[model samples]
Each structure stands twice: as C-alpha cells, then as structure tokens.
Target: RRPRRSAGPVSEAESGGSQGVGAPLGVMSALEKQLHLGRLPPRPPLPGGGGQSGSKMRMGPGRKRDFSPVLWSQYFESMEDVVVENETGKDTFRIYKSGLEGPVLLLLHGGGHSALSWAVFTSAIINRIQCRIVALDLRGHGETKVRNPEDLSAETMAKDVGNVVEALYGDLPPPIMLIGHSMGGAIAVHTAVANLVPSLLGLCMIDVVEGTAMDALNSMQNFLRSRPKTFKSLENAIEWSVKSGQIRNLESARVSMVGQVKQCEGAASPECPKAIVEGIIEEEEEDEEDEEGGGSVNKRKKEDDTETKKEHLYTWRIELAKTEKYWDGWFRGLSNLFLSCPTPKLLLLAGVDRLDKDLTIGQMQGKFQMQVLPQCGHAVHEDAPDKVAEAVATFLIRHRFTEPIGGFQCVFPAC
Candidate 1:
C-alpha cells in the first residue's frame, strides 16, 4: 500500500530543500548579473531620407524588409500618402500605403492610438501577402484632422471609413479586409453591419467590445478612477513611467507613441509647465471624484469643472465622449446587425489585462471565432507581434479571394 501522505501545507524552506541545496543561491546569483551587459554592439544612427529607409525607421520593429533591393530601396518604393475627406465633413482621413499589388487591407487603430500603430504589421503584411495595406489615422488622432464636432460619433466615423475606401480603391474590386483595434474595431463592425463596403473578405476585431457611448464612458470613468495621482511635471511623469516598468522594456517605436501624447513644449525639460500638468491632474481628480460620488454629468459639465478647460481641454477625453454616443447606438443594434451580416470574422481576445471577459465570450457566441492569446495584454499586436503576424498570415491565406497562378492551392496541399 502507498504511504498515507499528510494533507499539510508545504513551507518555502522545505520546498527549496526538496529542489536540492544551493538552488536558491544559484538562481539569485544568476539574476543578480545582467545577461546583456555588453553582448550587443551599438547600432549606427540611421541615415536621413524621405523615401523607404526613413519610412522603415519610422515604422520600427517586427516589420519585414526585403534585402534583395536593399532596405532603403524597398522602403522608398512602399512609401505613399493620400488625404481623403470624411463624408461627415468632420475629419480629413490621412491614408498611408504600403505594398503595390495584391488584395487591400484596411487597418484602423484604437482610441488614443493612430495608424502608426499598424506600421510594423503593415510592413510584414506587405512583404508576406503581396497585398496592399492602407492604415488610416482617424479624426483627432495622429495626423488626421477632425473638421466637425458631429463627425466624431461612431456612425460618422464608420461612414468616413467607407468614404476613404471608395475614394482610394473604388475603381478596384473591394480588395478590402478590415482589421480594427479597440475603437477602430467598433467602427469596423458598424461599417460591416451597415453594408457600407462590398466584398469585405473578413473582419478582425482586436480588443474591443460591442457597446454604446455609455459603455465607453463607463470604461473611461473606470480607467481614470484607477489611475495613480497625476504628476506635477512631465519629467516626473516620464520618471514614474520608467520606474513603474511601463517604459523600461518598450521599443523605440512604442516610446515614440507615448512621445506623441506630450502636448506642451518643455515637457522633456525639468522646468515643465506646472499649469499644464496641474490641469491634467485636476481633471483626473475631478473625474474620479464625480464618478465616485454618483454625479451624473456629460462632457460639458466635466469640462466646466476643470479650471483650465478652455485653455487645455484634454483632447483624449473629448474624443472619448464623442465615441461614447456612437457606442451607445452600436450596443443597442449589435444583435440585429450581427444576425444580418454574419460575415466571417476573427476576434483576437487577449487573455490578460482586460476588465471585461464577458464581452469576449459574447463575441465568441455571436459567431466570432476567438483566439485567446496566452500571456497577452490589451495591446495584443504590440505584446506578441510574431504570434499576431502568424495568425494574420494564416487568416489571409485561408480567406484569400485571389488565387495565385500555378501556386499551392491549399495551406496543407495533399502529398
């Protein structure tokens, strides 16, 4: 008979002893030493140019480059931009292009993020699929300018996407596959449900839930409420970010994304503008206080609560509020819309760092196949670029409308 084991808890020392002597010390010693102290040679500063090399540098990591023609040559060949007007007359859609011939992929970014977020993925897709990729900077974000306040709504944003698509590739068959993150994902769903574009091969939603403006507002309220106290200066903010491990392991491109959020001059300076920083601090405090105190208020009231509202309106907050209205309508009509469309869809659900799991579950039940990326956070593409790339490639290959001449018919071609 097997010896009866005591149902007792194990202590750390006992556990360590069981692993053999000196294991803890060896582990500690190894961790104490830096692994890459002098392993990597310094990279040379990139050369200046307006074409592909510059664009490649701008695009940053996890992006593919063809070396046959050289990095610079390929980069130059892939760089182009066009300005398309939003149908709602609220924004100018700045469309950046990569890849020459192939199917079209429209990449839309999430709230507080720009099309530049897709730069790495765009580069990879362009090289791998021989497909044209267009990344659009939505209104009030990145280089895109919002022309009208009304155009900020979700429906209008979806309309803007349709307009830009028609304007750029109307002549061509709808060689478009929609990939959207966060807010962009919502817009993509809206566009699909509305049947704004013909022949949408697939829709990929990255980390967004189906909902209305109220949901967005609630999300923002929760986010603001959970934030640490605002800093007195910009340097302090950066320092805090660095110390908190937020910016420590981030790539240069990711750092650049944060840099774009710096609004005031001398933000990098030690003597940063107190007024600007204070305004941010005050707004966050007010938001937290209001939400906690059960004060039901709209954007105008929230703005009025801040002393520097006229001078330093948080563009992010305003944009969020505008999006909330659209989300409200979307949430109400989501079921009917999903039933009506039933288009093949890919939903990349992050396994970590998300507040709502039900949203993802609901999507899965609504005929959206979910790929739960283990150990990934809200920014699935950024956190796991290789995995994302693989998934994207597989998706494209599976649903590819255009067949390659004299090429493999299936991913798993029969022997």
Candidate 2:
C-alpha cells in the first residue's frame, strides 16, 4: 500500500462486500471474493501526515485513521515459545494462550496469516466459555522459527502441530479442540487423521472448504501477485489492509496485522509497531470513508519520487506465491480427511456455496455440524469474531466439550 496525498472522504462498502451498502460501492473487490484472502477490488493508495514528508503531494482533508499494530498480550493471557525437536534441529513455534485451566482450543491460522489472527476471537470466546486457547504461529508464518520454513507440506505441518502440543502438554494432556482457518483448517484435518492430537476433542474450520479451496487455486497466483509488496508505514499497511478488505474489523486488523508483515531489510518506518494494552483497543466502523480515494491515490503515486516509494516500506513476512508448490497438498482430498477423522467436526463457512458435493452429502448424512455466517469475507473468524466465538462456544457447550464461564449464555446458529 502506498502513502500519498489523501482525497476528501471516499465511500467503502459497510461490510466491504455486496451487503448493507449502496450499489456503486457494493461490488465486492476481486480479492474479497476468491480464496482465503478472497476476492477484493484493487487496493487504493492511502494518505498519511507525519513522517511521510518525502512525498511531493500535499495531504488531503480526509481524516487519518490509526493503523498501529496491537500487541498479542492485549488479547491473550500469555505468549509462550515452545521448542520442538526434529532430525534437522529444534524449531521454536509461537503460542498465544488464555484461560489457565480448561479444555484447550488450539487455533491454527491460514496461510500468510499468523496466530494473532485469532486475537479477537480468543478474547471473545474465553469470556463466553470455560476453555483454554492455544494459538500457534505455524512454520514459515508469524514469529515461528523452523528448521525448514518452506516445508509447508500437510504431513510436515501436521507433525509440527502434533509435536508442539506434545511439547506443551506431554502424552496425557487435557481434552483439546483444533480450530483452524483456511490453510490451518487443512492442517487440522491432517493432524486429526494422523492421530497427532491424541487428546483431540473437536474440530472446527472457519471459511474454508475443499471444493472452494481447490477452485481458488487456479487464481491463487494472480491474487498473490496483486497484493502490495511493500507499505510506507505500519499505519499505511494497517489502513490498506482494512480498506482492501483483508481484515474487515479494524480492531482485529490492528492486532492481527502485526504478524503479517516485517520491516524491509534496509528500510524501516519511523512509526513501527508498538505494544498497547487491550483496554485502549476500540473498534471503529469507518468502512465508508474511502470511496472517493481513487483520484487522490493516483495523483500522489504519480507525483511521488522513487526515493519515497522504495525506502521505509514494510514487506509481507511470507510470499504466498512461493508456497504455491505445496498448495495442492494442502487441500487435495481434504474433505475426505476431515470426514474420516473420528473427532466431532464443525465446518464454518462464509458462504454455503463453498460446500462441495462430498461435503454437502456428508452434511446431509449428519456426519458433522455446519453453520454458515453471511455478510463476511473469506477470513470469517477475523471479519466477524464475536459471531464466530458464539458459534464455537455453542458447539463446544452443546457437545459437552466445555462449559460456559463468566455467566455467559449460549446462543445457537449465532450471528
């Protein structure tokens, strides 16, 4: 995302999709509709004041939004680094947890996203239920340091997850539920099938289905290349992510975005990420503020010099395009694996259309539970974390996996 002179207020869809918005801004961006990053429109350049003195154009009247990356502790109780040993060496995985003693809900994030993606949901669920949350930054993503980062095969990642759980709790651990989004969903399926989590209690996948995932592969490369390789500042990155519909909830974007990017080797922003407390984080519904940013974005980019464009821009931590080698391995026969797993299963999707023939049949046969939440994009958990928490809490409680805490009540078909 670029930092340029802002135009006056522009309109963005309320939900960043074809919902609750006027026609002109209602069309969903290509990226907002596709795979995990789902289809969304091309991103517009963002405007900011302070530190961006290098740009030639003057700032516009549009209000500058706070895009600071929030710290993990704001949402989780603790951040632990678990080291798992392998033939190559020891790999350290990042785990963010809350709720000291209860059934564990191990959260695995999607490709390109990190454990922090579960920030909002973690806070919401723990308040509603008596459950422990253990969110992992899978290999090659987030703060995880692995022997071979690029080894993203399902088998390797599944083993990596199993090893981490074993390292954290040992052979006889408490009952655990595996919750994953997109790529992480596939890993959860594989982990269960491999008997990796012997203490496994239940499985929940958010916004990912085998049929939709397989169809999305053909356009995955194009979608990856469409993303901005660098951002002028952390705020710029966060703003772009919101406006571009990467993370619909501003609060979620603030905490989750920190793990999605890293400072460029030779260029770092003056206003880098800062750790702030949870009480300070508040959600702002500013979706309609960027509809008219097109002209200003074009003008600023045209006037900005090469010096401003290349220096001090942050890049994505991982390039999803390169991981293309293992994409098929992540989703092929995924439905079968998920169905075969003996654990209780829950598949959460953004759209019911994501269901394939097999999964649809399985649902009809009552093999697992299915719930579809509308008005959200591919990152269902991030876009609508409270609803996700409700759905999950209901599932866990209904199955007697864990009890609700804090006087929280359960609401089925939540959202």
Candidate 3:
C-alpha cells in the first residue's frame, strides 16, 4: 500500500532515503550539500538579442532542418537534467536556475504536452527574475514513459511530485511557487493540498479550474480520437496538428511535434489502393410488406476486400492509455482541492469563460487572486506568454518570492 499523506509537509531529514538522478557527494547528504552550498552546475548566460533582433550566429549549411530556433539556442544547454525515483517509478525534470540563493518555481505542463512547453516562458523568467525554475514531464507524458501503469490516481501522481520536490529541495528550501496549466493545474492543487512541498509560497493555475465544462472535456476527447495513430513525416504531423487546432503557432507546433515523435524501427510499408466492387444481385423474393408499399430488404451485401492494415512502428511518445485512466479523477480532484487546499493561490484564465461559469471567482476573490487575459486561448502561456510571465512575476512578488523588477521585458525574440 502507498503511504498516507501527512497533514503538513515532511522534511528530508525525516524521510532519509529519497533516490535521485545522482548520489550525493562524499561525507555529505544531498540535501545538506545543496543547502550549505551550490551543488548544481553553473548556468550559462542568456543569449543576446532580447526582443525580435536579427540572429548573431551564422547559418553555415545550405538547407536548415525544420526546428524551433528558440529551442535550438544556447539557453536550453544551461538547464540541468534531473531524474528522481520513488517506489512507483522514475521521472525527469529540467531545472533552469538563475542562482542558488533565490526562490524556486515548479512548473507542470498540461496533458498532451511535455516539460518543453515551458521552455519559452522559463527562459523569460530566468532572464528577468532571480529564481530557479523546474519543469516536470508528468508520468506517461514527455520522457517519463510508463509501462503497464498500475496507478493513475491523482493521489499517486501527487505523491510522485512530492517525492521529486523532496529530492530536489530537501527538508527546507527557498520559497516555492507552483505553476501549472490545464490538467496540470488540477495536479498542482492536489500536490498543494497534500502538503507535499513545505516551502510552497503560492499556487498558480493557468486556463484551468475545478468545474471545467463537460462539453469542453468531451470535445478534447473527441479531438484526441480524431488524431491519426501515426504520421509518416514530421511535416505531416505538424499539418495535422494545425488542422486539428491542437497548436496555433507554427514554429512552436513544429518543436512540439518533433519532441513528441520518434523514428520508426522498421522499413516504411507501401500503401495499397482499396478495390471497389460494382455488381449488384437482385433477390427473387420480396417482403410481404414491400407489396403493401412498405420498406423492402436490400440483399446487396458489401464486402471489405481490403487487406489487413500493417501497424506503423512510428508513433507519438504519449502514454495515451495511462492518461485516459485518470480522466474522471482529474476533474473530481480539482473540486476536492479547491475546498481543502490552504495555500495562497492565483488563478489565470484565458479569454474564454466556459470553464469559469461555475468558478464563481467573486466568492473566492478574498481567499485567492484571479486574473483573466483578453484575446488569449486555452494555452494562455503559449498564446500570450509575455502577459502570463509578467502576471506570474507580479504574483511572485506579492508572495515575497522576489522584489518588484521594474519594466519587465520579454526575454525571447519570439515573445
């Protein structure tokens, strides 16, 4: 059986054996080393060209591959790759740091998206704010693949998130800020209510709320079902993604598709045209109802002459079955968290109000902060990253994570 969640956060000193990406240094425990000194590698400086400036680096080759230029930059190289494990399984998180002496921001992406979704905004945060950012690719999403998933419970996912927090920040770390989008927002609240991260200063939910419309959920499920099982090429996948309204921005969509897709193991199979038959056989006998001008039975039988379809080795990296297992619980968990979570919180919603009709923000206004961005879609950060980042920075300041940074500027050229 899984362990019971504490009413409050547990310290690293109490939980003695949390396995992580790598073992601690000699004579000192991992938590002790991190607390007393800076243990991680030094972060590389942010690249030049703050806002929409021409590229300084040269393009040497004749034909450049279709990749997000922002994702290919030097900024990504500075992020520390980390893996943490508990009884359940191991998962990876990318840590972006400004310094060791600052607050930490834990970012969780929505379903069907990886930790890389935060790469653009994380860069923005590190460039302007003095804070460490960590983005987790939740179980069955991104690089954290699950085989034969046993537990898809919100409690299970929250517990894993807690373990990760303990592994990275230890018993006591700097003030923490939790940021999550869509389905991730629900998980964020579950983690907070569980009292997983002791130093958690505030929680921010983007484009998600406890009572998201049932129609919205059904629409998402339908869209997922409509997607092709596999794509022959990256470009083809992007085209489908755009047509399906999964991603709006072309550049970002390309990056997302590339990260989510893997090469096929076997040779590509040739497509065969389906044959159509034209002959029709008339039945000699007719129904008695047909004689009385009623409906008659058509005896023309249609046969599927097509050959059995071959399974493509190439497919999306997402663990669809595992994620689907938690569908009902994801919504239910939110209602529970909204009622019980004691942490200070901020809720950021896009332009649409379908998810907020029952939210009744006015009632909870005193208990938490709420903001709505005009002209923004479900993926608020990706749709209006600058606005989202600035709002987050302001929220952090309000929570005392960092002092106000005047005239906040966009960190990346794309933004």
Best by TM-score: 2
Full-model lDDT, candidate 1: 0.54
User: Once model 1 is optimally superposed onto the true structure by TM-score, how far is the C-alpha of residue 411 displaced, in angstroms?
Assistant: 9.2
- Tell me each candidate's TM-score: 0.59, 0.77, 0.65
Q: Compose the digit string of candidate 1's lDDT tens values, residues 211-326.
A: 43235566775664443333433334433433333322133134224322433333343323333332222233344667787554455444544544223221221234444545
Instruction: Rank the candidate models, highest TM-score first.
Output: 2, 3, 1
Error of 2 at 345 (Å): 0.9
Q: Is candidate 1 or candidate 2 better by lDDT?
A: 2
Candidate 3 on 1-415: residue-level lDDT in tens? 2333323444556445453423233334557556534644554444543321222122453433343323524334355646776575665654443434467788888877767667667656665566777777777666664443345567877876787788776887668888899878888888888788888888888887766634466566676765566654556566555445565555566655655655455444322112222221211223243566644444222321122122333356664544665777877647546645677777788744644443565335466667778776577776666677778877776666685444564322111
Better of 1 and 2 by TM-score: 2
Could you give me the TM-score of model 2 versus the true structure? 0.77
Worst 10 residues of 1 by lDDT: 67-76
Please provide, for model 2 over 1-415, each residue's C-alpha lDDT reduced to its tens digit, 9 standing for 90 to 100: 2232232433553334442222222243444323322234455555543333222222345544567888888999999999998676899999998998779999999999999999999999999989899999999999999878989999999999999989998878889999999999999999999998998999998887888899999999998867776776677678777777777888999988889988766534432322110011111212232454444433434344243544455778988888998999999999998999888899999988889999999999989999998989899999999999989999999998888888978777632
* Each prediction's whole-model lDDT (CA): 0.54, 0.80, 0.61
